[model samples]
Target chain A: MAVYTEVTDEALAEFLTHYNIGSMVAFRGIAEGVENSNYALKTTQGDFILTLYEKRVDPADLPWFLGLMEHLAAHGLSCPLPVRARDGKNLNPLAGKIAAITTFLPGVWPRRVLVEHCEPLGAALARLHLTGEGFAPKRANALGPDAWNDLLQKSAPQADSVQAGLGRELDSMLHGIVANWPRGLPSGHIHADLFPDNVFFLDGEISGLIDFYFACTDIYAYDIAICLNAWCFEKDFSFNVTKSRALLRGYMAHRALSEAETAALPVLAQGAAMRFLLTRLYDWLNTPPGAMVTPKDPLDYYRRLRFHNAAKGAAAYGL
Target chain B: MAVYTEVTDEALAEFLTHYNIGSMVAFRGIAEGVENSNYALKTTQGDFILTLYEKRVDPADLPWFLGLMEHLAAHGLSCPLPVRARDGKNLNPLAGKIAAITTFLPGVWPRRVLVEHCEPLGAALARLHLTGEGFAPKRANALGPDAWNDLLQKSAPQADSVQAGLGRELDSMLHGIVANWPRGLPSGHIHADLFPDNVFFLDGEISGLIDFYFACTDIYAYDIAICLNAWCFEKDFSFNVTKSRALLRGYMAHRALSEAETAALPVLAQGAAMRFLLTRLYDWLNTPPGAMVTPKDPLDYYRRLRFHNAAKGAAAYGL
Candidate 1:
């Protein structure tokens, strides 16, 4: 477990006091991330996740993190709601770290999500985007292209000998993206990290969704591209057209896109490919020795990038 | 300007007592990045980057980060070399944050990269991998599919109702990758984040590389996939076959891949695609309101994913 910070049971109990979640019964580490500490807590009232903001999470961001949970929960999203404190605050300092308690949702993360699931997830994502329509918080994209550049600059010294060539290629790619970036797509709140684990299911139904730390305002089609990359590929890393169709069809079921949006899918997917490819590549090149975190394969996005390069039409995605 | 933790100059000066970089001439915030507090610093000896460890970075990982810099610098990689302190330490605590000083290289990030740059970057990357041959490290793939799933679980709750389908699709897609993950590929050190920003150049030649926080041991071909995604795409996020060939050829110049490795390119690219798609999709679905980070278009990878689905031969990439 990558428990960079330790939280005590007493500290958790004190934090839970702020939330009207009744009595706390049990608390245990979630045991899944290289960043932050999460505990699965079972309270006398119900099950909840207790997150102790670890080293990687900024204390200042806690309000947005917790408030987003409360806001989403209030807006009818089936998710863990942050428990409020006596002072009406969702965040509290504990054990010399910021902490919060959230209602534990019921359901299992599908290990074998099927095509049927894609439609609902897609629709739900669209609805989520709609719900965030009027949110007035002052935050910005936390890890956008600019941040990527900075991170790259920070680790350039260790980039081996190919740093120069890689630098040039990356610069060109970035410049190209900036030059031809799609404009006038429905820009609003987007769930930047809607992968499998964050989604929970009960008997083939999506019971809830979790995690919103990377959420920011960006293109809606970008979300669809992300789904395609995550859902459409086979284990051999080959894209599966059938899966792509399924995901797109599902997304379209709830949200109708304009012709411009539809036309942008291919290029949007390419940009999405670049985003992940850059992050993965950065992590791959900068993994510290003896760290517990695993660096993802950069090749996965490479093939996806190629596919976008060869892509000639968006109709194949049922757009 | 996302300075999660601030390091005062006094603290930096005290910390510099352990290094041979002489006295600090100047240090100021660089006014960029959503993670880490980066300052462009000038020492009595030369210009450098002083980074104050932010929320996302672990203090314990400082040594590995610094050591990797030292290792790469010794191996002829043009990157920031960590300046040792008077106490001969590469790391120091300043203003409640872990900090390090590195010799900054001179170069500008290219606005647009070309195929011509791909070859050198690829070759240099190959050489970097070769340099890692004797260095012993134990970091694994941190942001792989499994980690993606975990991140998804964390963010699913904040997904809007419309995005419900995305959650389902993502779950299914992850399961697909896990069930059908490819096999038989050479594994070694990889620069996970090879985005353009990390690479620096003088004129048209590569001068330096930076950022090693995400380096890890993974498939060598995966690195190629990452570079492809980073360098081979057009402004509209379309993959360019010509660019792909240029990148592969460049990579081949420095590291001659095995037949098995070459055979794995398409699949590796697919995996890379999925990895990026998943992360981008997740980010798209989870972007919170008013965040500084820009959400990347997920559709870009979707098209890329589709293209890989049709890829039956590796000849397209000049393998």
Candidate 2:
């Protein structure tokens, strides 16, 4: 839960004069994301989300994120449509930060992931990958394989401060992954951070997908690997085979996996686990004392990575 | 920003089964208040606020706070009405804590208070006191004059540690206030914590008053004093006479102040400042290291207390 910047009502009123959305009736800072300051805004016309991009988000990547949401919404995938201003620009400036308003979507992300949740998530994810076929903008995943070594270098010095011998273990795992990293396997736009909290559900069906800040061109199978790590694990980090079967089968119903994509699942899943592990490790080490946001335990992903390392093939994923 | 307890989707679904409000659509924890976990809940029926009372709130006083809102809303004062379930109860247990749903009020609280804000605030506050004339339930102000000595005792030891001789100054001030505290100034239900953030505005009008947890039967003049301390002070701690005059005039337009009330304004304002100073000092000293909520500077109220100490009479408050 984060609201790093406070926007005054006078400044907000002045900002709204540029838009066609009528006067602001209400606006509330939403305690949801860590990367941006978000407000639930209601106006004379309709309800929307006002997002102020914080320093953590690159200003250069703002257009890609906004454009991806617009493209996906236009292609019939449920997501926030950026509320364009009279100047035909969705992104504008407020309180010395880039800000944009988007149409409010109505659905809650599933808190306790059930088997029922995995199927629709799988189907919507496939649709997202398919609909994002020709999006004009391109964003390379900043946290992709090429970035892992630098992240590990920064986190390695103090990695064992959190756990004994953890740094050496991570170094060995990184060496193995770099040696066997998959290449040239069906690249497309992927929601690089498709965690359970980013997917919304209504009436037991997937209502929408959000937080496209991490969307970038990557191996589509890697996106699936992220979901398998996110949705198919229990609180105790135990793998749920039934849920995995449902998620994979549901995805197959929309887009069949190539044999190469199938063979790549275990390594992709391992890499996905490694990706989150390194980032979480970095955050855990760097978060200042008494920071507003709490960092997730890096060991949670370490546990997931261990599970993926032992898997034989897609068969181990219940494919 | 506080959301101490996370309510799972399954628990929320079960909690909603008791209410007539249709299936849940969306809910996000709001980053606004300090007392409880508040969520902006949307359903098929309409928008509402779902509050889960944290340990800071006394469980015994839940009914009083909820009932006061119901009473005030029913009596034509703009406020959030507690929504009763099919069981005819507004308060119920959810996630092992007491929770309730209230009708959502549509307006943003003023981020920066203006002189124009004070008049409507004064008039609405008077209306609130008038409408609360015959409220069936009565809750004593736990932070009233009687509680000041105890609060001082708890906070006094560390007071001088914060500033040289501050504890002795507070001790003398407490002695004078205890001896001269006003009585019989037309008491009624008061929104004791009417900070700018607690009042909502739309179209330059006071749309609603919220946060009734601090509402109690107290001297009506003291509530005005609290407002003077809150709304009529500039960031540099100087009094704004124009805003105070407009506020006082607006209140008189609704209900005239008696001679005794007018005479007691200076001492009452001093006590009001002392009340906040003691509590804030206690919180400042006792707040756990690395706690999420930052305690407000006790010295801010100490500055207000000094200003009120030098005030001559009602004229000092722009009467």
Candidate 3:
């Protein structure tokens, strides 16, 4: 783990003074994440999460994260509400890191997820997409196709070894995607990293969604593609069409996809697969030993990429 | 994107002093990564790469990264040789971050990989597995089954909403895999990441390999499984038995699998598929918007998981 900066108890206490919470209790040295240092903190008023800006998180991007949380909260989205600082600011500085406190959402992460949960999640995601309209942020999609090409170049020197074949495939795939790229879907603020850990549930209902760090402007359907990748697969890496339908139906209930968006689902799915495959590939190649962070298997994404390549239409997704 | 620490020209100059490389003539920032800051540096002596410990890299793990590089270089693996410090140490602190410089290998990443490449890659992977026999600096497999379970827990809350029957199916699959988990196979250090970008080629032959960060102690055949997932699939994600055969032949040429290992290959591939599916699922649920990282489609892995689940024997892989 990279401990770029540490928040001392005194510093945390002082920083908490600015918040509207009644009292402060802090847990420091939380897990090291790529984007933020998250501490589980408690206050007299309520439990909250204190996030220190890790090196990977740009200070300039803090407002977007904070504002998105506030926006989602304001729109009746079940999510953590950012607490204001003493100066009435949602963003604050603590221990040489940009910091913020958010109301802690309550729920245990599910031990075993069931098929029935997809509908609500799909609905919630659609709601999130709808709520993201008009959200003003300066940042753009970070992991778009151009960025993938650049990553390939960095790893290009080693491309011809046994695995070098993947580079070629990825290059061609990227070009294919670009040439046939879908244009002009409903674009909005997207929760780019809506992985399971970031979502909080109460009973069977989604009580809260957390971790808005990777949120950015992109095609709305792309988020659905992300969810399809996330929710419609079994443990053995098999696609469950039933699950795909449920998820898509759930989303459609809240916000219907345009004809173009529906048509682009398969291609979008392929792009999504390529995106992850490239990242996993990059991580697999560059991850150093003993970094504590695990690099995901590139083959996983490779398999997904291949599937998307073969997929004929969005009908497979029931979109 | 995350400049955890800036490396001054002087610091880079100091780094070059110990290496037998020539003058530092060029430095280019690689903008593709979400983890570290990499600069493609050219020295009068030869081309090299300078990697500054960025967000995801732990400073404490610098020695392990450096040592691994040195070890591989010593063994005639055509990888980057880390330049040691003036104190004869491979690890060193430069600027505010730990950094290392390594000799660059030669090769262009293939723009399109042919099925023929699989043989060399498979063979190279087998050689890598064999050579990893007693290499020191032990590390645990990062994303084994246990990690998959953990991700399941995290993503469980949204299970019902994301897929219709996926949660139940996933649960069943997990139970099945756990119950039928293979007992044993040749275990050793495995290059968990055998993706194409990490391999270097000269002409049609593999010249070298790079990126040992994800190397860990695990089942050797699992490494083969990873390679199969990476190399044997077509653009449309269908299994190519011909490619699979060539890859297996290459792998067998270097390190013949035990009967037990061969017998376990299909199941191992299933497990590999599941591992990827789970991670992709997790990423799908948690991706934040606007981040440069792309979330992969879970369905691709899901289908693969199903294929592996149905695969009854090693012959399925043309072995």
Highest-scoring model, DockQ: 2
Q: What's each prediction's TM-score?
A: 0.48, 0.96, 0.49
**What is the DockQ (computed on Cα atoms) for candidate 3?**
0.01
Q: State the fraction of real interface contacts model 2 keeps.
A: 0.66
Comparing to the true complex, what docking class would candidate 1 get?
incorrect
User: Can you tell me which runs of candidate 3 are displaced by over 4 Å?
Assistant: A1-5, A26-34, A159-164, B1-319
Residue by residue across B146-171, what tens digits does model 2's lDDT show?
Answer: 99888889877888889999988898
Q: What would the per-residue lDDT of candidate 1 be over residues A223-245, giving only the tens digit for each residue?
A: 78877777676667677776677
Docking class of 2: medium
lDDT of 2 by residue, A1-319 (tens): 7788888888898989999999998888888888999999989997899999998899999988999999999989999999999999999999999999999988889878999999898898899999999796778989988899899999999999989999999989988887788988998999988898899888888888999988899999999999999999999999998999999988888989999999999999999999999999999999875677878889999999999999999998998
Q: Sum up the clashes in candidate 3.
A: 50
Error of 1 at A211 (Å): 0.6
DockQ of each: 0.01, 0.65, 0.01
Rate residue A150 of model 2 by lDDT.
Answer: 94
Candidate 1 ranges beyond 4 A from true positions:
A154-168, B1-319
For the candidates in turn, chain A alone yields TM-scores of 0.89, 0.99, 0.92
